[model samples]
Target chain A: MTDRNPMKDQVAIVGLGSTGFSREGGASSLSMALAAATEAITDAGLTAADIDGIVATNEPGASGPEAIAAGLGITEATHHTKPTPVAVFSLLDAARAVFTGAADHVLVVTPVVMGPWNSRRAAADPWRRGARSGILPVPEDATMAAAYAAWASRYIHEFGATKDPFARVAINSRTNAAANPLAAVDTPLSFGAYEAARMIREPLNIYDMDLPVDGADAFVLTSAERARSLPHTPVLIHAATSGIVGKNDEDQLDGLHRTGQHVVVDQLRRTSDIWIDDIDLFYPYEGFTIITLTWFENCGFCPPGEAERFLREHWNDDAQRIEIHGRIPVNTHGGSLSEGATRGTGHLREAVHQLRGTAGARQVDGARAALVTPGGFFFNPQGAVLRTAT
Target chain B: MNGNSEETDEETDDVLIARFAGNGITRDSADHFRGRLDRRLLMARCADCGRWQHPPRPMCPACWSWNMTMDEVSGRGTIHLLMVLHQGPPATGVDYSTGHPVVTVELEEQRALRFTSTVSDDFPAEDLAIGTAVEVEWIERDGTPMPVFRKAAS
Candidate 1:
């Protein structure tokens, strides 16, 4: 729980690129990775020769660092490794590499592809069918995606909450998605439509889960000294951390009070000077609606079990989205719920765009700081504070 | 209290691994699965400190002690977490069309110690609520003994 942060604002995200997202599922994970990786390198005003590091994420169907490097013609990389999925793990690894002089310019590429396990369309595709060859089908269980539903029931039982807060998370993302071209489902969601959505897991309907889509997001990281010459406003990494408790197994977790989210908030608050009140944009992961609600409570935006009321109070009725304190916009990029589950990469990319004043219609005016909390409570709960160079 | 008449206690490690192909059977957890064949719900308990753990581990998490034992539990607990799945992976007896109910129960032996399984068919779905008392009940799935839960007698 030390507040020591020597890396604070030392590394900057110099470039960002994305293949957007699509449910149509025509491209392979490798192609998407290459596409986004190349675009990101070009966006950073660098070439393959300049990238001496590669940090690829271990997404199920995605390519590894070796494959990505070979595809991009990066012949020599001193620092190349595959971190586990989710955006910040790779971001942190790349930032540390650049800071420690392992590489001057590091590229982080994360690709998400619909697999046969989650999507029926992907299951029907012959090429995707092979992806499940080694996997064994198990009986019904409350793990992984199902764990969220299990915990959501506990949250409702313990708090005596209605479905309003969960519905709001979906609707808010949908409303914001309408303005972002990168979003998959841009159709504005209404409270009635959310309530009427078919229930896939009890207490959580189809709308509650993130959509499985094909996409990739990539970022370029370099020391702050090198970022000053970049074209876009350098979004500095103030503090980044991933947290987890000992008994993190989905069903065995110590109730809602203490979780990885709490650990992350504790560490981030200690390391970063900017708190939630100072941020103009919020990107709490919405992989599950309940996750979004809990992040609000854990991050101290409001008291526990009061998200429904807090959201209702601060919700901008005219915009149909959350505007905390009538100013700070949440998930301005539509988030994983509507942005096709780039698995927190969309949240990171959107935050970078907004902080750089590049987000066309979705940008918050004069947005300077962003608080991005990505991943869920179990294994990958993570948080990072990004802001323009002070 | 053995669930199946055909299953014998002499099954080899290879045979046991083949039977529960996807249960993630490892040397540390093989004993737990072996107990399942005999209608026994065995959980790992630290021999040194008596700390209990589920989904067995090679060493005790609390004290890092190598001495551990697979001991039977009373299987009596209250439903701590509940999820009704309207869709899921294909299982022998699970009919997702009717919305399969899966629950993780907090065992009476220790707080926060839990085991996850489906409820027995006899337990009415309407009565399947969190905090309800439940006990282990054995049922056959694809000829393999499977442990489920049923509402405990008041």
Candidate 2:
């Protein structure tokens, strides 16, 4: 990767909004998107007319840019495109749009809905039944989400690991989630509770996977120069990148020794001046408990196969969450595991909140810099560093 | 081998696509599925570079050569990854109550070249462990041939 990152700290996320997250089946993806979009626009102290660019994510069942723009009553936009799901793809597009002057104010909206395939409550709803039409009637296979469980088995086999590390990840998110009203499952989780959870996929119980929920998270980004006048303290995008390698097919991966997570760490370390030693908070995606454990190892928080040991050493027993070096908290807004899956948008939004001193009860004291690594191993591994404007 | 007529071959292609529609059938991988009809496990191999790839790609990733062909693999390998699904998509002969085993095997033909499938019904569940030697076994699924793995004879 090239060291030429002129966009570093050039763009700032000045506004943030979320519809929270819930497993209850009541809202449509569009309605949630519009709700978050309007809230974000208001938070940014800007009217709809100020948004000249839109970057909507094509999350399953999510609305496109035109629908979102029309919903917000914005008539014209020069730069509007629908990037693939997950938060960073849309964030990168919007940030690049603002940095290059393609648009002065860009809105990145990501809405996630619990589809019929994943949730029984959704499957029973008539509106969500449409999502079941195109799903392939294939036999059981280890791909996509299943691939994580399949590989989790490999991790345990290779390292002789027990369920403690994965259970700690679950407990940590639950502990943090209790402080945030927006979180879905805020009930405190204990080792016994996690171990007792029914196995949806062996080696990975129900607690191991992210909760499928209906929610949306939106952000308003503009050039750092323009962000100074915004109502909230601007959270500057220090260095952002997505990483992948060839042969990324889930089952075809080159073992746990290397993955897209490794590539992301390599790139971020090279580009960002603020390394892990400088960050006050960490938000590694917990779409799967295994993903979070790997992030801990891949980010150099600990050596490979030592997450269980690292977590045990650094875990705050009273708080029931991980605080690296007893300072940098992991997933302070809970995570996909407990916060409901916004597919990393929640991580980005919480990072912004912490940096701006708006995280309320969960805010890190005098938080200045944060490391947010989102997405998973095979397809969508992404990382970004955010810091308060100087 | 009996249905070798050109007209029958054309019909067979359409039939194969429809039968394995859930496999994400494409021109690049159609031949690999066709091999399954004869109980043969075919993986893509580069004609120019001899590099092996799975889930069949049209061009060789190693050399970017379009000259690739589906060649039979010995189907003898060790399980590299395994997961027993307590719940999953519906399929014939799969009883979730007992749990279903899905594994990706590291083919003896090439390192890191893998294929994902279920294990045979009679395969001892307790014996299913990663690195266990296995060989392909054909079974009927929805009136079509499906390849699974069974513990290889020691």
Candidate 3:
């Protein structure tokens, strides 16, 4: 069977906007989505009526594309999508809609409410029950952090890596976030403080976890040709791909460092002639510190088991001077760790900003292209290469 | 370790018992391979591909064969991974606020059958390490039997 040519440099992200990251209570999911979506459309110099496609990240009963469309007073959407689980998937959908001539001016939105919940409180929410019963078969006795902790344990065992590298990741993320005015947690992370942090799980402390924050992030995608006619410089969608390993439904009990992850990285690289060195910035999802570590290895940033060493030799060398500002910066917007986790949509928005040179304080110097990978437990991993329109 | 199933309908004050939400549910296709802590036999192997799997599913992941069989595995393995959670949602009435170590074991019979269970309070926390050998035992929490692990004698 002939492989389909990569959908490289076809679509461009014309506008990127967010309601800024917060620790909840500012607004509801629909309101945040509306604000972000509206910002994106207006930033693209297009009215809501100009958007004909909508792709909303699906959170059951959570307001989706239809609500955002109506909230924006968009009269109609010719190609509306059901709520998707992953932001990258929604992005791919938006890009495809523009690529396939399905629609122009596609809007993608994901909003999340990041607040604490308890078992008793969960019992009161009908939507919570549906999530527990139908979609995720998580054991009741299992703690929320069990899965990542397990993967980390195995990673430590197999690689002989210590918690120091993971600590560094948290430190770097916070250091970057400190420069970000909209970051949820902007406090500078020191190694001493990170080490002193109480361990929530062995080998994982509070520093290793990503804080849940309330906010929404949205983007506007159109044909590269169309993007040229718009207001802002277009961040061309150079390449993109998404898939799962073994089976999509298999419980990932084996571990997080899957063979399939390498496949994704390779396929994304093949989408364009761009090598890893050509990319100016990197944004691997930081849901957990170990996630970034594994991505570093699997995404071919460094050889296997060399991520920690690479960090030691390169990242930690100039912590105060070059930590946030680096040769190839990772998570310039602080990522989910310090930047608010808008269910990971924040990473995409940050990538677009970095590419456009619009990321003010945390901007990477002369960033022309970026590699963004979004992944988590049970997610069909997805990735994209975004480059500035030359 | 073997014991009768602690199947009950009455609400118990056991926090871990309260956490056991999949109490009544059972998969129909793989009834032979039971995960109940009380079961002497656990895990299923594909009769066609000889692949061993746990939390029993219908087909073999390796060979995708419907031919499968069940048998008891040696209730011993090394801790493949572990997490000691200090702060977590409180179990119904039990005070786990101090936290507990959750472990995943790579079974000696088949590494694919990784079983996750909490270590007993008596298990040495300071000694826990990856690759440390452990043995399974059935214990009752508020009269509800569940599987737990203890460090194996060297």
Which structure is stronger by lDDT: 1 or 3? 1
Docking class for model 1 is medium
lDDT of 2 by residue, A1-390 (tens): 234788989999998889888988788889999999999999999999999999998788888999999999986898999998887888899999998899999999998888888889998989987784344456556678888999999999999999999999999999999988888888899999999998888889999998888888999999999999999999999999999888898889988999999999998988898888999999999989999999999999889999999999999999898988899899998899877878899999999999999999987889999999998999899999999987
- The residue-by-residue lDDT of candidate 1 on A150-226, one tens digit each, is 99999999999999999999989999998899888899999999999998999899999999999899999999999
How well does model 3 score by local distance difference test? Answer: 0.71
Residue pairs with backbone atoms closer than 3 Å in model 2 (clashes): none
Proportion of true contacts reproduced by candidate 1: 0.82
Identify the candidate with maximal DockQ.
2
For candidate 3, the TM-score is 0.87
* RMSD after Cα superposition, model 3: 4.8
Residue runs of model 3 more than 4 Å from their true location after superposition: A1-4, A115-145, A247-259, A316-326, B1-37, B67-70, B92-97
What's the true lDDT of residue B46 in model 2? 88
lDDT of 1 by residue, B1-154 (tens): 1212245454586899898877767766888888999989999898899999876887889999878888899999999999888887788888988888988999998889999988999997667999999999999998888888999988
- Give Cα-based local distance difference scores for all models: 0.89, 0.89, 0.71
**lDDT of model 1 at residue A272?**
94
B-chain TM-score of model 2: 0.91
